[model samples]
Target: MAVLPGAEPFRHEGGEVGVLLCHGFTGSPQSLRPWADRLAAQGLTVSLPLLPGHGTRWEDMNLTGWPDWYAEVDRELRALGERCSRVFVAGLSMGGALALRLAARHGDAVAGVVVVNPANKVHGAAAHALPVIRHLVPSTKGIASDIALPDATELGYDRVPLHAAYSLRVFLRMVDGELPQVTQPLLLLRSPQDHVVPPADAARVLARVSSTDVTEILLEQSYHVATLDHDADRIFTESLAFIGRLAPHAGKEGTATVG
Candidate 1:
């Protein structure tokens, strides 16, 4: 499949500390480019891979599923692990779910995890119909670009592919069941006004994860896409701080300054 402009994956080799960033479902790496760049500028090796079936069209995504997306990120995480002494994974929305799966599966290989409005469970009765509805309909309205910035936009599909969404629900359930296996340091950033993911999702994760070191930061100014919203700077700076605290040697070179 032909990759879209500005939607390509990103890689930066800076130091021995590696960070793998995963973009949300239906959204391309463009959505997290700024965040990746900020991390790279701070002298951390970073890899932001474009999930399969994304950065193209909604019709294409219908042919793909969650397993395909997970495989892509997992491959990148392994590669990063081999190259860096310490590795951290960060993601937004569905990407966050993928990150959690990586941490659960890889264990100590992943030093820490950072997520923004991570989605774990689908709420309401509508979720129950997805298995059948996906076969009847092609897609629904999309849930991308839920940002507070008036002019900011997330590069993503305009519609949500039913088949793919069904796969996402299945993936969520699996991840939720494995949450107790995730024991790495965790930094969760949630937006109070998010319209896409409910707060209960975050609550469920905090309740289920076995991680002893966990921090939750509420974003009062942003929406679902907090990484690209009004509180983007906070997300960036706080993430650097989080990484620094977990792996101080990575931040010892110089202080990260956001312009």
Candidate 2:
């Protein structure tokens, strides 16, 4: 079910703990690069992969659906399992929804999940009233100017594809339905002033997930894209601590829950 045809498995040369980083919608692996590097420097092998149909022409992204994106992350999770004693999965925005799905499905294989500004539901009444009709209407195009990324970072697609947004709505529904099954240790981080995903959406996930070990951190200075914002380093630091807490004991190394 892998999305990438003939793509080889990801291998880590070192590190007993592995982290898989998933980016947001219309976003490339670049959004997670800085966070991945930080984890790698901490001796954890990290994989920040380009989702299917992403990091290319925007039209390609419009062609793919959420299932394809999930398949891609599932494959990476499998590869990470192959290389480490413990694995943690995390994502940003739509990536957060994907991360939650991974934890729900791979409850045994996954050590934990860190979700940053996970978009689970659109709160606006207008968006809710005409969900289908809105997809037919085009919105003004432009990525946020204060995305808080270095000039070299891939900000996002300038033009928001209607079909792509519709696809995300479908995925959010998928995540919402599966939230109760996500019982793994979870860290939910949200930007209070997020313009894209309402903070209440994050609260909904926190409220529904069955996990008892859940921590919610509010980013005062960041926007929706917390991975690249002012609080990004805090995310990395907190996530590292979360992973460390779940790591297998040295004497109990190689002990992991199997699906």
Candidate 3:
């Protein structure tokens, strides 16, 4: 299947500090392109990978599952770990869950974690029925591009693949169980108005992560896709500050160190 224009994975080899970025479930890297470019401009190496089963039609997502998506991001994280002295993981929505999983799994290898509207669980009566519903339904309404800015859109499928969504739910629960293993510095950004993920999701992560250095930001003007909404610049700027604080010599030109 042909990848949609602007949905391609992005990589920039810039400096000794690397940031691995993951896109949300069913979402292409297009949703994080500007965020990646912003970090790249600061001379940090960046990897924004298109998760498996994404960047194509909605039906294609049904052929894949959360493990496939996690593997793709994990590969990028390992590649970044090889080249950079410090590596951080960040993501939006399901990508956030993946980022936390990386932090949990890798321990000190991940220097920090950042997430925007990270999802950890599904709710409502519908969620309770997903395990059975997925066996019968192929898809339902998509929960994409939940941005407050008018005319803004995300390059994701128009429908949610039920089986894939069920996989995501299972994956999130797995991450939730491992949250206490995450010890890296954490930055979580949440939008109070987010329609796709509840505020409790962010709260739960904060409560579970073993990291003492955790900061939470409220995106007053955005929604679930806060990276592309009005608070986009704030997310980029604050994330840069977070990275610089942790890796002060990150973008400096003279070093070729890897840790």
The number of the candidate with the highest TM-score is: 3
Q: Which stretches of candidate 2 lie over 4 Å from their true place?
A: 1-12, 123-154, 248-259
lDDT of 2 by residue, 1-259 (tens): 3233312223234467888888888776667767876776666767777787676656666678788899999999999898878888999988899999999888879889999999896445544544565456654353432355455344466665656666777888888999999999999988888878886888899989999999989888887777777898999889878887888431133222211
Q: How would you encode candidate 3's per-residue C-alpha lDDT over 52-156 as one tens digit per residue?
A: 889889999999998899999999999999999999999999999999999999998999999999999976678878999989989999888899989999999
Per-residue lDDT for 141-166 in model 1, tens only?
Answer: 88888889999999999999989989
Q: Which ten residues in a row have the lowest lDDT in candidate 3?
A: 250-259
What is residue 113's positional error in candidate 2, in angstroms? Answer: 0.7
Rank all candidate structures by their TM-score, best first, as comma-separated numbers. 3, 1, 2
Clashing pairs in 3: none
The per-residue C-alpha lDDT of model 2 at residue 54 equals: 71
lDDT of 1: 0.91
Candidate number that wins on lDDT, 1 or 3: 3
